[model samples]
Target chain A: MTRVETQDRRQQAPRRSLTRRLWRAAPPGLRQPLGLVAALVAAAWLVICLIGPVIAPHDPLAQELPRFTPPGEIAFLGTDELGRDLLSRILAGARVTIGLSLLLVCLSMLIGSVLGLLAGFFGRWVDETIMRFTDLVLAFPTVILAMVTAAALGASLFNAVLAALVVSWPPYARVVRSIVLGLRGNDFVFSGRLLGFSAARSIRVDILPNTLGPTLVLASLDIGTAALLLSGLSFLGLGAKPPTPEWGSMVSAAVSHFDKWWLGVFPGLAILTVVMSFNFIGDALRDALDPGVERR
Target chain B: MSGRAPVIAARDLEVTYPGHPPVHAVRGVSFELFRGEVVGLVGESGCGKSTIAKVLTGLVRPAAGEVEYHGRPVRPLGVGRRPLAQTGIQMVFQDPGSSLNPRRPVGAQIQDGLDLAAKRARRSGRRSGAGPVGEPPADPANVRRVIGQPADAAVSPTAARLLPAGSPGRWLERVGLEAADQSRYPRSFSGGQRQRIATARALAAEPDVLIGDEPISALDASTQAKVAYLMSRLALSQGAVLLFISHDLSVVRLIADRLLVMWAGRIVESGPTEAVWSNPGHPYTKVLLGAIPAPDGAGRLPLVPPSAAAFDAPPVIHAP
Candidate 1:
């Protein structure tokens, strides 16, 4: 009987490994085509942000082209009124526009989720203090609050990011807090407490892992919004002062010469593509993380 | 059971949930559990069986009562800071599906009990002379041992019989679970298998008082008997006091050494299992026993008639 069981196990082993190997070797794109395309687009922007200066065909700041050149001029996407290449300027702007938005979103998410977890888990006074502060911050429109803070701190990119960070965190705190409150009364958490786990230990070991998927989906969704808000800040002259290649400031510069058209359209298209890609990635992430939702 | 102090004793327990009309969940209920015996507390829904379990485990504080472990009163001391004595009273909740954390591997959940046990042993200085804390003791039983074995070691000959393969497999195999499946999540297993995992976790603590609040009712008819038998047998072998709470009298009778029947937040009857089964003293006990359908298909069991008002009222308290 033992020999027969061993023979049966040996027969099953190779078949399992072969299927797993085949699955692993298949490209991720083949399984979820839309997600793959979105990921590729997002990855291309990140690569461009890193190597923008090296790959630009012309010096972004150097005035070497005819003034207000339209598309198909010596400059690929034509030139700004000051005659700088629009393609090169857009390329260099990707770093400040995309990079700063990602950094601010990450910072806000970290701050918000921690406060939320503590408030939901500890309750009573801890809940009261954190939630009241969150409520106060959330009372104002986020843009108005961010604009005021950025203006107060002087119209610069750093201050704009800091301003956005201040307003962005309250939503995350609210989301994480609600999730933790729901799980607080779950049986597994009670079981953890029965086994002599401290509140901190229970939050870390039992509750935190369950909350991660939802929080990640929320974070992905927020990336596009963060970029838009930062661009809005720059457009208002509260971020990315001139001489710095920022897409929002570049578009703002185009507004004076509305007839020039190419100046506004190209930079607008760059923002659109990046934002759309992130939104798609967020949709894919939500589908992947939520077990209740069917994958399309 | 005589001449030895009870492992756990409850005195005049009362629980009331405040509202427009206060709900008195458990009123003037008391019981004592001796080590190495399965004492079944049988009742229908909302008869305070779960409340009693909660009061004993210190999840809910009783309005007026004290829970004594080995004759000394132990109060609830918040989470993670539970007194070493109170840590020995572990509970297995009814819904096996929710009792185990869905995200965690079953092995880590089992290991939680083991790690806490080791920590308790270290703090109490019980292992000072045993050897290094990490080293396995020379006696294989000690390596797998729970705290404070009952005076009669020979009482659980069935402990050896239950797990013949030896101690290395630990608590998982003893409860009829695969030790190899320890790393898998709770969603991977069926309801019966999850119940087995829950039982394994409760027993891994080597608890002195193991409370099963409707532990097997959620399982299918076939798996119910197997899980119930496994739970009682394993708890008894560890020299633990098994408080098997269930609505199903049939499953309870098969494993319990003694029986306590509850009605309207009070126990109406108490005695040895066979005595209560054969000649129940209380009308409520009689009604409960009669409610169990006999498989011979002789006749349908009578439902509780409106005329049976005596069965709904609380019976006179009897000290056991």
Candidate 2:
């Protein structure tokens, strides 16, 4: 058979097999209810974030009503201190907050995984150099590092994401490096070398696949932390400047008007919902991905 | 058999693991492997039998000396750009479970070897200006000579094209696995089946020299016999030189043409398998042979003392 046919056959086989395995491995009883609820909530949140701007009734920034208006017919969640729709602002903010967090997580995972694979595969000097650098980055608390990076780069939505990416990648690298260190000595890797695979090819084929599951679990868990950090940075005036309608920025705007519960409550709930959903999903993924865990 | 050129030859190979004291794994070990010949390297655990196999297959680099393929010194661990020499050596590891990537299907793992073989074929074909057919290329340069004319003047282009379409399935079948079983992951298979898959993978490379580092040690007696029989048959069919490393004398005796008895990192005895079985020379070889329990439940065999003299002195008996 030609290469294309072989690839086609393999592709066809895996899709069916994967679905079957996943169906068979689905969580049962209380775990199932917990996992299903978490998955649904996370999925719902992502959908809302994706379509929030399209469906929002009022212009998030429009000052159409009197400032600090209570929930009524025109605006379901009431108006903010600026007389802007709290509901619309929260809806608009979802896109920026969630999207930036996702991007940061992906970028960090990519950078971290590659460096870790290299360090783990080629031990001794290569391992030491990369790990020492990772240790340096990890020495500082994550938020402090993000704060310093944001401060250095100048605060904005993009700069906050960049800072988070810079600060978060070291953990992924450390996790992947440890995983690779354990797997490099496996007989499959040795066989790969004996089969004339180059070091890079062996790492890509043998090491990378094994590292992905754990890294994915890490990525999911970190997304919540990243979202929280990004929101915290914006609350501190280091991210998504005024009139941008970011969740954290909205909460920051509501702080002085302590009696205007609508301004803080809705946006706070949005952040809480998103972060909790991610944590749930991450927990489920950790259990699912572990081979030692009994799926049934 | 006597006149046949050795496919691979090691000269005074030494491998040491760097540490506080440094492990002297294999010391001054030398052996020659010929086409279609199965040479068993047997010793008790930690005697460096596996290390010798690793050295021969280029998995472990020797601290001193070199491994020559067709009279040329190839890199000990497939580290260099010499694709021709690299493709010629392949190894099956001892642990079947760990020898396969858990995430990948067994078939895909087998295809890795096939892919390497195909690449090697394409490269050699392009270099020789012959389209991977007819007689093998005659250029001494193409033979990857280290210092002299290669005993085998040409590498068989057939070796490269050995894995055609559906060849992994064919190899799996040859190793007593189902064709459809290739689609399954390594974790899905039993230890014996996984070993068979690993064997299939090694055979798929169509290597000139195939090394089995305690390949059957992990299997039960029945599976061991079956896999050993399959390996010997496959090696003969492919005309590949087989380096069967094991501490199990019975298994080696069943498969090997010649035997190299290792004792504390040195080959203490070397001879035809039957001859050595009949009249073992070297104290270590005698001890190894005596250690094999008699099948008829007879009285205990006499215990041979570990020879300290062999450690300090050169081998006293060299078999012809």
Candidate 3:
């Protein structure tokens, strides 16, 4: 039956074809102008987070300008009551606020998704143990539980993240568990088992890929909420310590200087833009990953 | 007949699913499949056809009786161990579209069978601490190197097509597809082509018994015959016992050498395909035969009156 079949002669694609394919398959919501703009803004913030301190105009901690200087050549966004450059402080805070949020989301999603896959696939006692724990965590109001955990862990950025992570992962477990429950019944998964694949192999190779879209959509939507919660903890002084340039602490510090409106307004605007941009991106992801959308 | 032990034997099998009231899915079903024979298991909906397929492949443990492969009792699947029956008996599922992993290329999906076979060989080789007589040599220390060996040089010719690096493309060709098509995803293939890929994957493992449970049910009428023909032909050519299960009698009649008719979780009639078609001994079989719509319009459609007696009657066994 051997023929001199010429080996696959299909022209090699450009090296970045994988990237192109991902771009093509991206949800229509992400491709739309609103989603694109939101993505651009989010990308800009992420860049600022990575290299914020270096690019910031002045020493964020330096009270060099005179107190309460209005927007001028000397102080662009104006100086806070402490005479620190508001632009420099907001720029420096972006790293702690956004980076911590992304970290919390990733950690929670990883822990929760793995637990959900195990609970859904193994189901009997495993399901009971995981779901009951998830319920216990979910029963508490999210911010309150995070606040209590943060307070208990002491005042610091790292402990705040740990508290947020503890509260945030339950929703992921619930969502991923339901998705896995539906997918575990698919014939491909059963066929994998029939083909002598181990339970772990079947779950990873056959079932995991199917759950990615929904899980990803959920993760994207949670980024902004994660940021807000972390900021909230910091605002309560149970998070970042004084002079750390965290947005929530900056806003809290401004309360003492109520007459200086710019003290409150700049950091507030920073939080709003970051949160709104993430929300827009999350909405687009949900639309893109919707089953009714043409993924091909 | 070969006068040898049956490849797969199910003796008085019963499967009861637990629910509010227990559903006796398969009640005292028995059958034997011989090498190189195509057996058609025909039945109406809800007659426990799929349940029997599951039982035979050891997916669902029968509450009573046993499934024996080559006279050895097939063990129930235990945690962390490969299913004993899986190495010898592979199944082609109902829906071709869903039977394949949509995210993977057809080539990698086919490669799974070959890789599994290599893994099984390595396991046995290690247990025996040497290559058993007439078995493939213990896989090279590097499995990838063994897979890269030429198909004919890798193992026995019977298993050559299952070499992970060597024969995915060849197996695709055996199922009437281009070797180049292996890289394509399941969605790109038509229903018939996907079923053929399913057949190729199952056959690649060099199983002794192949169970196709309504393998063409999701396909169009035109594609159904082609896929059904391809399956029986390829399975026979490989000398595997092909237990072809389906509800449509016409397709079964075209390929099956022997026929087993099932009703309400029991095999009601058994005989050669032609013998059962010509002279159905059971009333239920007659009703089933009559229900097939005659496209030429020569005979009127037969109406089946509700009869408890027909369902409960003893099975009619016919000599081959």
Candidate 4:
């Protein structure tokens, strides 16, 4: 038996290794190109968040002569009501918008995934209590919940992030819990038990890994929603305070000066682009990770 | 095999699911599994065959009665913080597709048993106050000792036994799987292939008792025969007791040396397979055997409904 297995492994050594299997699953032709472009745009958005502060043309908080300036070569993209460079403000806002949203999403995913695993794997009253709480959170309108949370927390960048985290985690918990529920009865999990693995080991090895693909796909999609919620709170004066130049706050500052197209348009466009980029990546990732969709 | 002490013995094992009206799944079931023999448990669906299997494997704790291993009562399901000891009992589930995790490669899945064996060996080694037993413990040679295979290599007397590398491939091969196919995920394989992979994984643990809960019920007839033959052969070669559970009496007759017939949560009749086939003592057993379709289209034995008194009577525990 040992000799035969060794011979088989040697013969199949040339086959693609396990890590490569994920990439090989990417659909060929149009979807592949689209997925690549979406991935690159998302990557670019991440890079902008990381380096945007350094690359802003002028101090984003600086009050200057030309306030509400329109699109042109000088002060290109234009200036806001405070006379801060619109281009510089939008670039700097990436740091707050993308950074806060990512942080919010990661925190939520962590909390949700762990809770979900616990509820699903342990079932009984644990499942009921966690899921009922999740349902209570999910029952509310997400933005309203964030707004209420932000209002109660006293409206700062930190408070807005906290609000988003609170509002966003329930979906993750719900999704992960459902996935875990389905997986609990699976043979792999039972196999883990039969092998004398501790419950913790079985969950870590057999259950948690299976939950990741769906949870990740949901998280990526939620990134766009989280960004929208963060921006909305900032627009409502509950996010980053003035001079911080958050995209939503920029649009709010420009709302009264609606005629000044660049002020609102550029910032609005920034939010749109970032949100769309995440949506695209999320869609592509959903396809990429789907077990049913065979890769070429 | 019959005269020796049973490796695993269940005395009046009962399992019930709590609900508005509790489900009485198994009642007063008793059985013994001797090493180097195959014992077949046959019953109609929902007659508690699978539940009994679960009780034995520690997946489901029996609500009543005890399962003793080597004469010591152990938790049916040894979850969290249990002492590290090879129960030498593994199960092959009915559905391979659902049994294997979709995200993992079959090879990785197969390797899990080996990894677990190594962990058990290490834990047990530490418990015995033996300094590290083998060279690095994870080495395949040391792993062989972990899985109960005799190791040729001389190592520190305190070194713990662990499952050797390439054992997964060997076990897969024993179950008629190609060694190279381990890299594929469970979703990529057909039903038969997946079953084979599942069997390999169960065998890889080198269990002293292997239980099949209708392991081949989902396979085609030809595939069923091949797998059944493979399982019995592997179990005998490894000196592991096999508990073959199925509704198909013909298949049970093919592999099992001892036959246990269960009906409505009770073991109705049991004896040597040939003896039971020649003369079924219980009415339910006769109905079951008569139900097997003959090639000549012969009529089945008249169905004998159990008397109401029979249903009301307390379960008759079978003493092996």
DockQ of each: 0.55, 0.45, 0.51, 0.47
Q: Write the per-residue lDDT of candidate 2 for residues A226-248, one digit (tens) a residue.
A: 88999989998899998999998
Runs in model 1 lying further than 4 Å from the true structure: A1-36, A294-296, B77-80, B127-169, B298-302, B305-308, B311-320
Ranking by lDDT: 3, 1, 2, 4
Candidate 2 wrongly placed segments (more than 4 Å):
A1-30, A70-74, B78-82, B126-166, B294-320
Q: Is candidate 1 or candidate 4 better by DockQ?
A: 1
TM-score top scorer = 3
Model 2, residue B19: distance off in Å is: 1.9
Candidate order by DockQ, decreasing, is: 1, 3, 4, 2
Error of 2 at A134 (Å): 2.0
**lDDT (Cα, tens digit) per residue for candidate 4, span A1-296:** 49999899678866977755555555542156666676778788788888987998888888874766677866878777777788888888888898888899999999999999999888889899999999899999988999999999998999999988888899888899999888888877887777766779878988999899888888888888888999999999999897787999888877888777777888888888778778777887787778787665
Docking class of 4: acceptable
Candidate with maximal DockQ: 1
Clashing pairs in 2: B58-B76, B72-B146
CAPRI quality level assigned to candidate 3 from its DockQ score: medium
Candidate with more favorable, higher TM-score: 3 or 4: 3
The residue ranges of model 4 lying beyond 4 angstroms of the native Cα positions read A1-44, A50-59, A62-65, A132-141, A151-155, A293-296, B1-3, B78-83, B116-166, B296-320
Give the proportion of true interface contacts each model preserves, from 0 to 1: 0.60, 0.67, 0.54, 0.69
lDDT tens digits, residue span B1-320, model 4: 46689999999988998897998999898878887678889988999999998888777889999888788775755436334464467889998568787778888877876666556556656321122211132323211121221232111233223433335654455565655667778877978778777877777666678899999899887677566656766566566788989999887787787888899998888888877888777767777887888878666664666666656544332333
